[model samples]
Target: MRIRPVGAYALLLDCDDPDHVEAWRAELCRRRDAGELSAVEIVPAARTVLLDGVPDPGRAAARIAGWTPEPVTTTAAADRVDVPIVYDGEDLPVVAGHWGVDVPEVVQRLRDTEFRVAFCGFAPGFAYLTGLPEGLAVPRLATPRSRVPAGSVALAGPYAGIYPGASPGGWLLVGRTALTLFDVHADPPARLTPGTRVRLVDA
Candidate 1:
């Protein structure tokens, strides 16, 4: 891990992988909760974690430099959520053809795999999920739809994601879920947060 100064206040933790970023973010949160550190936000991205609202970036940098991280593991006691999906997407056959498999195989592959919310981006409540096998990674659509409906479950590159609200998208849709991913009236709006474990169950 490398700590780099971000402007005058924030520090960015450059991690090797998503696992390291998540593990390090969780560790920082632990420190913050224990009163060992104070920060306005410890934000995570695909390969980097940002410590915003830092009081002393230089001091924080020194502390993080000496800190060692434990081995990263998937079963680190995180919140698990099951999302029900209807495997009736327009791109079902497209993905299957790309994978050289039938439609049912596509559904089975998604149902059997365990996923985690790596980070949220693109739109509110839109979670970029990790844990899809590399063999199943599909490319994004050649032409993006003018508007994708909310609750659409899609895949792009190595990540799987849910469309929290109707918007334009290019990810290959594989299914649809009934769950509301984002709610302004609800506490903490987004249901999927970083490090949260998720599974797609059949609807």
Candidate 2:
């Protein structure tokens, strides 16, 4: 792990991998909620956690350096979301060919996997979910679509994602849901925040 300064009031922790990032983020969030750490935001990304709005970045960095994070376990039931999907994407056959499996097998595998939100990026309410085994990782499209409809469930590398709005994207689309991923008028705009567990079920 490496701690780098992000301005005078924030610290960016570069973790070894996504697992490390998740572990550290959880620990930091726990400490902050318990009044053991001071920070305005504990944002997590692919392999890093950003501790922003710290009053004393130097002290916080030093403290964090001495700490070790454990693997994350036990997600609260309320944090789990079931996204209903209809698996009839244009790239469904392509994905099955890549995996050397039948189309039905692809859907079954997806349904069996329990995914977790690693981060949110690309666009508003677009959560990058991780859970697919490394061996099942898929490549991005050679040609990205000019416009992907909102709620498109897609996969790229080892991450599964849902397109929150109509936009150009390179991820392999496999399914879609009717659930509103982002709503400006809602209390919490994004439905899949980091650490939330997700299950994609048949619509």
Candidate 3:
């Protein structure tokens, strides 16, 4: 792991892997909750976590350097969320072609594989899920759509994601769920947060 100063108050922890980054983020959040660490925001990404509003960047970096990260599999059971999907997307055939499989096989693969939310970005309530098998990785669409409908389950590169709401997108759509992924009235608007386990199943 590597720690670097970001501007004046933020410190970024560059982890060896995506799992390590999540472990570090969780530890920092625990400390923050117990009044051990003063952090305004703890943002985790694909392979890094940003600690913002830190009083002493050097001291924070030192603490993190000494902290040993835990294995990623230790995620709590409460973090798991299953999303039911209907495999009737416009790009299903395209995705099958890319994977060298039939449409039914593509659906089966989604049902069998487990995925985790790596990070949330691009839009509010939009979670980028990882854990797709290497063989299933496919490139994004050559041209992005002007507007993609909400609840559009899609794939791009090594990540699988659902469009929380109508917006512009480029990822190839494979399926969609009826579950409301985002709710403005809810305490936490996003249904999928970082480290949350996600399973896509046939509706």
Candidate 4:
């Protein structure tokens, strides 16, 4: 695991292989449980884990380096949220055709595999999801869209994501879900926080 101390309280660990996911997670979990790391939160993505909370970054990183944790058994614990979707995205057929699968089959695959918010980026509440079916891992459009409607379910760069708010984007849109993902008035403002679990349902 390649570790970097980010800011005052976060220890960033970058993993080179998917096989290292559990091993890296186990180390962090051990430190957190033992109170070796006073992290306010722990955020893990496809290739990285973040320990958020500490008085000093240097001290935290040193402390973490000394403790060798037991092996870890990694499980996605991603919440299986069912989001109703409309199969009317402009690129739905193109994606299905790209994978040589029918439209219904594409939708089924999307809804069947629960995805985790690998990270939130490009916009608030827009979560990059992992666990996309191998068949559905399509690339982004060559040209970006000027504005994608909110709740648009899309895929790009081996990751899936929902459009939280209108913005220019290049992801291949597979469908549109009715779920409202962002609201500025809400307590947290963004519906999809990092580490959220999600699944789509054809409606």
By lDDT, who's the top model here? Answer: 2
| Most TM-score-accurate candidate | 2
Question: What is each predicted model's overall lDDT from 0 to 1?
Answer: 0.89, 0.93, 0.88, 0.73
Off by over 4 Å in 4: 7-10, 17-35, 40-46, 66-78
How far off is residue 87 in model 2, in Å?
0.8
The residue pairs found clashing in candidate 4 are none
lDDT of 4 at 17: 45
Writing each residue's lDDT as its tens digit, candidate 4 over 41-97 gives 776667787778766778777776776545533345454466788877788788888
Q: Model 3: what TM-score?
A: 0.94
Which of the predicted structures, 1 or 3, would earn the higher lDDT when compared with the native? 1
Query: lDDT of candidate 1?
Result: 0.89
Best-to-worst lDDT order: 2, 1, 3, 4
Error of 4 at 139 (Å): 1.7
Model 3: colliding residue pairs: none
lDDT of 1 by residue, 20-122 (tens): 9888988888888988777899888999999999999999899888877666566544468889999899999998998899999988989998898888989
- Worst 10-residue lDDT window for candidate 2 reads 70-79
Tens-digit per-residue lDDT, 1-203, candidate 3: 88999999999988877778778877888788988778799999988899999998888888778877666784666778989999898999999999999999989988888898888999999998988787788888899999999999999988999999999999999999999999999978899988789989778
How well is each residue in 1-203 modelled by candidate 2, as lDDT tens digits? 99999998999999988888999999999889989899999999998999999999999999898988889885887889999999998899989998999999999999999999999999999999999887888999999999999999999999999999999999999999999999999978999999899999999
Q: Which residue ranges in model 1 land beyond 4 Å of their true spot?
A: 75-78
Ten-residue region with minimum lDDT total, candidate 1: 70-79
